[model samples]
Target: MPATENVHVWGDARPLYTYTRYIQNHFGERVQKLAVDAGLSCPHRTQGRLAGGCTYCNNNAFNPSYCTPSKTIRQQLQEGITFHANRYRRANRYLAYFQAYTNTYAGVDKLRALFEEALQCDGVSGIIIATRPDCLPESVVNYLSELAQRTYLFVELGAESSHDITLERIRRGHNARSTEEAVHVLRSAGIPLGLHLIWGLPDETPEMMLQTLHWAAGLDIQTLKFHQLQILRGADLAEAWQHTPEAFQLFGLDDYLEFLVPIVEHLRPDVAIERICAEAPPKYLLAPNWGLIRNDEILRRFEKMLLARNTWQGRCWRGEF
Candidate 1:
């Protein structure tokens, strides 16, 4: 657990420790992340390894149209900058976000070349690499450690759930223990770490979801991203839901807000809350439609609820729940 002394001090109007605040504090200015596809494949979806991907994952749902592996890294970065220019006009600096598949699922030399390519791009300040925990072998971790020493780097692991049973149900090749071990390795290397969790998974009750948050809080990490499981059209979960919809506990927007408020209260104050919900393109999304509401709107509503209840992040971290 994080130190509790002065845990309640937010120093801002936001009720939770948001990633935006963390970025402003670290970079001294607003920094935008330009998502780039590295044309990488996951170990779980490879021919020799586990063939099927995660049941709830449809990568196309979250990826922007400009982000594709077909383009060069520099092309993607330039296009991404132009893509977000209007919305984040103040963002002069940017981070090259390798978000598609397992970014580190390659040889150290290849990974280094790709990352350096992005670093060489104009206006790019740093890099954020997202990959599966089991893919971070010692060789990759060592390379990332060296990279972190010179530039801003964040390694986000997709530890979708902390329960081994749920992990298996989703066909996640590795168990929760892989995430724990990866966290330890990354922390030892002095790498800033982030863990991603899916709130609504098959057979995961509200209590189980909270247990995953508690488990993640104990890890040596600097960030957390909570994504409500979305049943996308082409995902394995969608097929299953079609067969038996009652088995899945998909959250309506109101139920999600009610469930998420307590999660914010229980989250460790020092950990930056990167995201609270997932927004898939409506064309790809199958169930639990929130009706054209964007992520920013969802966040606004959540913060309002937090203030109305007079609660904030880490309110229950010291066993106050």
Candidate 2:
């Protein structure tokens, strides 16, 4: 009678492969991700693919002050561990997250050195490499497969939007085909895959946003994360919104909740949702002000909304529907 019966990892409340439960199930204890900047630069920024990186990007908006590339990997990991220990006391283990720019755009030898360094750090159980879809050359994919056998590793690709038009407008510099190819290559290499997508980009309607989930549900990826577009200071997106304003439709907290609830039903149950919302520092944020609510509070609100409607994840999954 209870939906939790059908779920193994995080129970009915989560409705998807929660990062917390997944780490616990695999490691026998909770593990937190310590994001490290690794001082990596993207081809888009340096090689003139687009010029100024993704239109929505400003690495400082998300990176903690301690996560500077100037510091050695060992130093960054030690500081991140301390920060998390004070904030999330439940986690005794960590996954070194290479989150800045295109982590894999560099040569395979450089990537290997950086990743191996993280793996050797204290309390780090594994590593998560966040990269662009266009950067995963065959050599990198092959190397990642080898690394997976030696240590726990996951590669997260930024597939941002499913629509090529939207990707172009946002200066993603890579198309949907490249994303699909990256997934196929990673799947073949036997590497665990994760995807990062953004909702509410300019010109994307609510219907179009839901379609991204439909697109993702068909993928073989093991984890997924979603964030609403945040027009942070110094971003080209913010400048564009400031000039046109009418061209974009940013979602306020309540509007986003209404939009997100039904979208969850359409996701593949096996795909874990890492995050549904993200917060930027108040000084940098420009619009759709949601006040100072933390991620946990927002998640709590989402759970309450689901129960009130009696809906669940994968309710409208392809075969089930």
Candidate 3:
């Protein structure tokens, strides 16, 4: 017999979706751009050489040329929209995305000013903040709750893995427990959350990766993104990889799918799966050239695997093992 879809108490995949891309498909005629840069750095990295940033971090590695600090927060937003508007000509709405560094790593009052400035923008529709789990303060949570009540708001946490050892190996400076606690605290506020994870990390097996997905499924997050670990152009990881390449196990195209198939099955039915992978620019990528493949090709293979097994997302999560 075929398995039937179940309705979830937390409002599973069908009725309400958390992704901005998914929402744009339904309501808006044109998608808007939001850009925010508050001068924030990870606490681990702020001390300079002690903890340094994550082994795989270079803020400029992925930073768009459009994102510049000379401009105020509001000026950055206008510039981002202008760049997109010239091409689309019809998109009028925007969401202010606080992307660079750790957006929440500041005083509550300063954070409030940055957020409020974006909300006041004429075409701005909502806000999406990208920050590490450890950086989100109580004041930030309360401030965001009020904003969620008034306008669309969500937070993205860099909870990259469930493996504590991997966390230490990467010098993440925060544990899986910290991520869980942060998620729990913020969930009570009712703003949607987006969790970021990387598929290929050093010392993690397929089982470990699935465990991360299962853990994520238990959360109240609205969306999730899976990124393949890219050894970027200027990242500290690249230097390490040169000396001890065996420390990393970068996946070929097929090996990554092997890791992902069960992840799709085990992830919560309610979580909106956003990007399956990040496209690392060739010039900046020190390894893992498989990112050159398109997202659609990967999705097609994933869907094929699901159909072949006659299983879909949330299937394993909802059933007996």
- What's model 3's lDDT at 15? 24
> What lDDT does candidate 3 reach at residue 217?
77
Tens-digit lDDT track for model 3 on 273-302? 776776766788888878567776777676
Clashing pairs in 1: none
User: lDDT at 168 for candidate 2?
Assistant: 93
lDDT of 2 by residue, 203-263 (tens): 9999888888788778888888898899999898888989998878899888898898878
Model 3 lDDT, full chain set: 0.76
Estimate the lDDT of model 2. 0.84
Cα error, candidate 2, residue 9 (Å) = 7.0
| lDDT, each prediction | 0.89, 0.84, 0.76
TM-score of candidate 1 relative to the true fold: 0.95
Clashing pairs in 3: none
Pairing residues by index, what is the TM-score of model 3?
0.86
Candidate 3 residue 321 C-alpha distance from true site, Å: 18
Clashes of 1: 0
lDDT of 3 at 264: 73
